[model samples]
Target chain A: MGITRRSFLRRAAVVLAGVAAAGAGWSYLKGLAQSANEAPDQAASLPSAPVQQRTPQPHHWAFVVDTTKCIGCGKCVAACKEENNVPEDPHFNRTWVERYVIDEQGEAYVDSPDAGVHGFESWPVNSKYQNIQVVKSFFVSKLCNQCENPPCVQVCPVGATYKTEDGVILVNRSRCIGCRYCIQACPYGARFLDPNLRVADKCTWCYHRISKGMDPACVEVCPVGARMFGDPADPDSAVAKALRENRISVLKPNLGTRPQVFYIGLDQEVR
Target chain B: MQHLTRPVLLLLTVFLLLGAARWAIPRMFNQISFAIQDRTVPVGTLLGAGGHANVPQDIEAWKARQVQYAGPASCTQCHQESVAQWKVGDHAGVSCETCHGVASDHTANETPLPTETSSALCTLCHSTTLGRPSSFSQVKVHQHAGEATCASCHNPHNPGVQGLPTDLIRPKPSAPLVQHVVVAEANCTMCHGQGRLRPYPQDHAGWQSPGCLLCHETGPTPTLVGASATLGAPFAGLVQAPSVPHVTDGVPSCTRCHDSGAVRPFPQDHIGWSAGVCLLCHQAGPAPAVGGTAVGSPAAGGGGDAPRGVSISTISADGLPPLPHTVVGYTQCQDCHGSDQFRPFPSDHQGWEITECLLCHKSK
Candidate 1:
């Protein structure tokens, strides 16, 4: 039982390994404890979200755009950018207006220069587009669908992207990893990576404005009253009344997103 | 064996330290962006399983951030000339956003205010597209502008491309109309006296009337005034200008245009009641004879009773929904009507006189 040189070395090694393993184990346990505490806090906070949304109960806000009434003035696009302080880059738009032109042969052409932030001008004098003889032409505005079961929320690894109880899909800019999973998951191409903030950005339905009982910027500035916003659940709400009265369709309904934003006078060619 | 064990042990310790740093550092000092957003995002965001529960509050909070229409008043300081001009012309009542996009976009950045250079710009409100209301100032832009910008020929401020004649004595096929934007500064004769563009009062005779509205507000009917009224018929007061100096007795003095047998083509029902009929429906209270020679000189003993039942076009088909022909589109009622010209308003119509005409004179 007396100490030999080889056996002594082995004993010292085992002691060192034990000490190191314990230190590493302590940190691991600390992490687990913090996560465990956070989970309960998250759960508590999560349940309250839906509750708060319901408190304004029976008031599920929604939006509707009447394509027939839209005059392609670019007022909504300009208003959206000015309201949200979105960067000027065309690619970073939270909302935009697109024009469609169908030719005599039943061919459709679409273009949105600068998201139609500038009102669409007539074709240039004797340009190719003018000669094409557009049989049908119209304008349609595009924004975040704010789906009831949003894939953007589901794909957010950090729970950065989420839905408000009112059904507004919003992003926690701080929590987002900028991995762009939500952007990829959005079926409507509504999501974009804000280059300035380096986070995923999309339409908040003028969340800052709508919450205060004011219209979203886009709706406020539309000259023709084409873009409409209101609570769908409230029978008296404009969107609700419109939905009740008008034939409406949502973009990509087959995906089962249950979008809060609806469209009136939607043409078959609009995607 | 010792040499290998020492390196392996060091490597393991370093890996553990790295893992701890990764979890601990981020957990404590996650992107400050998160902190900022947490404060900004009103509660009830779709951050959870069922989404934002505080729908009422979160949406309420966010609503404040919604963008609003900065009206022409907002742009007055920056665009004095444009707004001032717009305030006066046919477009005076139109929203600046209707043509200029949003005010924020123009004011925030030096994004030059967009100029409307296309036919589409003017045609949005002016185009004679199908399904448009008859009261709207509809125009066949394809036939009119002919690939030219409406602003080129019309002044956006004062879109009086066709100065109307003050009197329309003849039967005009079409009346003079003004639109939002059109030939702004075209010369006087560009449309007025020109043969092709001239809007003659009578397309049938190719003759211009004295003025489209001089004799009457709208197209005249073949029936002379009160031709169908028999003895003692009630005559509703007329809206004619008071300057005509006509008598307001029981009988409507039709001498203004009724020249007895001199004027032919009376209403079918007026076959027997010639313009020469003397004091049949009226009392000779103290006025001149019917269709008398001297103007404003009525025979004595005027004002009589009602023919219990006579066939006179009811003072108008009033109390009925507005008819298509009476619409002027320029009526003061259209000011508050926006696109819905028929929107009911409080009896207290602000500045403009919502005349007796608008009660049934719907705009096109």
Candidate 2:
């Protein structure tokens, strides 16, 4: 049957519209798949990162921070930058150490000069500091908790920031609208807007490494073995053994975030 | 000419229409651009920039200020000696820029790094503050090397005492006592087994001062066989003095600790000698009188060291006594007096006016 001219025009328009829609859908699918592949290593997608293939493991990961064991070395802070391309601005830390200097008066004054990168070798440079003797000083290391009940995931305007199947909190940069609601929602102050990417960024618990059955860079390079990562479900794991024997606690437990990271010897002064 | 003229006129009319529209355009767009600037711009506008759209400067500078770190490997090329020493040094794991500050811009502009001579810098890691972890060494800044550059006495890379105090070293003749290395896993009951009589809470201040080393040093197992069980005067006299100056200088302000109360008052015997100056009458034993050779009188600065053949009293609290403020052994004031932490040595050899350690202690 011969088509009428008006009908032919209408049919041409419809075909063009279908083609455009199909092309758009295909491109989106390709990007999604690429992102999934890139999930094994956050920074590995970059040209300089060493190529590593992930081996899937059947377990939920957990991290432990023993405050007594932490030396305020700042090694983890430096390693995180190397592993995740974190910015050098000391203020934008993925993980940082807080040195709680409790004076003789029993008041704690916390400071993390340069996020303790070089270490507080000669702090209190002023002689006035000498007058106030330090009483109970210790270090508290902080990072994203990857909470089970993360407010960041719930408050996200779009599903751009969501939890992974393996219980990781992640932001899909492509989908992120940079609304910063997640930053506001995070209780740990772990989230920040990446100036370079203009998107919400935070500690991924080194998703790329964890997915590959490896420890995160911060845990890997800790000099004093203060930070530990392993499958908490396994009784044989170091983290599990530590948890079994010691009294551990999480920050802001009242918030009900159910943070996966636990702390050993958490002091009363620490938040 | 006729055909071209119609097309030209049509194009001119279109331009005229747009120009007129631009002049009379509603304020909605101005408000819309303002809104986009104040809020999230549509995806198309963000990507397109709308050419003249405003953006945060901090975000724009992220790319331009991207100075990649010049890792240790880069510094290794020029600072070969420092790199080599650092690999085996105390801070082996620390990156180069940590102590030197970020060197990426320095590499680009050959900027000088801050000196490591500042006492403050050294104290960041080495200060003898109270709450440090076990194995790390702590120092009272004033008593260290006085004002000398720390590198003068301690090789920063090698990290050992430089120019050994000739007087402090083990003397040539007496030297067979093995140093007991204390392991971390502690169980006091292992040595001082269960049963002990509850002695009266008698005050021992009236007794003679046996010097700082008498009660605070670790020594060979003491012979309680003939010795009195109580940790008082008779026992103090029986305690054998150390052959070397028991590093009392290392714990100068350690006096600050004892000075802060326990019921025990300063020994009455020390009263006639000098107040607060424990070293005047109570001297460290003679040079290390090792195996076989009997310990001699206290060196040139002798102050009637306890009788020879007698070992340092093996009293309570097991053999390991309370830690003396400073390292024990090396009693001669000159041995460490003008050095790090102890510089500005007392004109009269007494550690009296030292409330602030940094006043006397410079980097060295």
Fraction of native Cα contacts kept in each candidate? 0.14, 0.07
Worst 10 residues of 1 chain A by lDDT: A45-54
Docking class of 2: incorrect
* lDDT per residue (tens digit) for residues A3-72 in model 1: 5557767877998778766765665466457556655543332111111122344446788998877766
- Candidate-wise lDDT, in order: 0.56, 0.57
Which regions of candidate 2 deviate over 4 angstroms? A1-56, A124-129, B1-135, B140-364
> How would you encode candidate 1's per-residue C-alpha lDDT over B1-364 as one tens digit per residue?
6655676687689989976865575456554232232222222222334333334433333343423344455566667877766666666655666566655445544457767677666765576532222444657776765777777677665564332233522343575653212333323342245544554222213222222112233213333234222211211122222222222223333432333333322222322343223122212222212232222211123234222212232322223222212121223323444223234333445675556434433344
- DockQ leader: 1
lDDT string for model 2 (A1-271, tens) is 3555566557767976787667656755675586566555433322232223333566677889998877766767877786678888886777888877779788877777787665655545223346668777777889999999999989876556766656777776655667788889999998987655667788877765565445676776675668888877888888999889899999999999999999998888888
Residue B107 error, candidate 1, Å? 12
In candidate 2, position A21 carries an lDDT of 64
